[model samples]
Target: MNINLNINNKIYNLQVDVDEPLLKTLRTLGFKSVKSACETSNCGLCTVLIDDLPHLSCTILSVQCESKKIVTLEGLSEEVKIIGDFIAEEGADQCGFCSSGFIVNVISLKRLYPDIRDELFIKNYLSGNLCRCTGYEGQMRAVRKYLEV
Candidate 1:
């Protein structure tokens, strides 16, 4: 089966099974930055920006994402560098498992809420992602600094 997808501002013709998860299809298509953790939607490791919003690729079907602009962490190299530098400065890259997903979400949040002003709001929004290492403090700090707060 051949399907057309717009990933990271590029068009791709993916030949994959219809039941394959978007995550698998993406990785097969060379989008390795889209991490695969929990196959279910529980983990945000497979998070991708769909239409500028964070969408878990593990939960979305490849066919359903035919026309959406899919932006993975690899696509956000500049933004990730900014966030990664902050994380390294704060010694936040412990396991490095959740960094990609967290960064994607932070980018999306900043784009959506340019003038956000609430600590609790930040905490609540990032709560969906889990990190066994580095804890949440470093992630929070990275977000705060990125948002210039």
Candidate 2:
């Protein structure tokens, strides 16, 4: 099937498999920052923003995203410096495997809930994006600082 995808502020017209997951199609299109770890959607590593909301690319069909606006880590490169610096300063990043998805979710949090002032709310919001390192304390700290709460 042929589809048009609006990703990272750019439109792409291409032929895609009917059942192809957005993850595969996006990576194939050179959006390497949208990493894939668990294709079953358990990891949240393949998360991407669809129309300003985060969704697991591994479970979303490319065809279903035809009219949606998708955003990936590369799409939000402008934020990486600030958020990335915070994570690094707080020592929240380790192994770096979950950084992309976690950061994307953080971006969503900042955009979705701008009034957020509690760490618990931040933790609850980003619970889906898992990390095998840092035990989340540092991450929470970084997020708090990022949100200035």
How much is the lDDT of residue 9 in candidate 1?
88
- For candidate 1, write residues 70-132 as lDDT tens digits: 899889998888878988888888878888888899888888987995999988777777788
Q: 57-84, model 2: which lDDT tens digit per residue?
A: 9999999998899999998987877899
| Best model number under TM-score | 2
Clashing pairs counted in every model: 0, 0
- TM-scores of the candidates are 0.95, 0.96
Instruction: Give the per-residue Cα lDDT of candidate 2 at 12.
Output: 97
Give the alpha-carbon lDDT of every model.
Answer: 0.86, 0.90
lDDT (Cα, 0-100) at 124 in candidate 1:
78
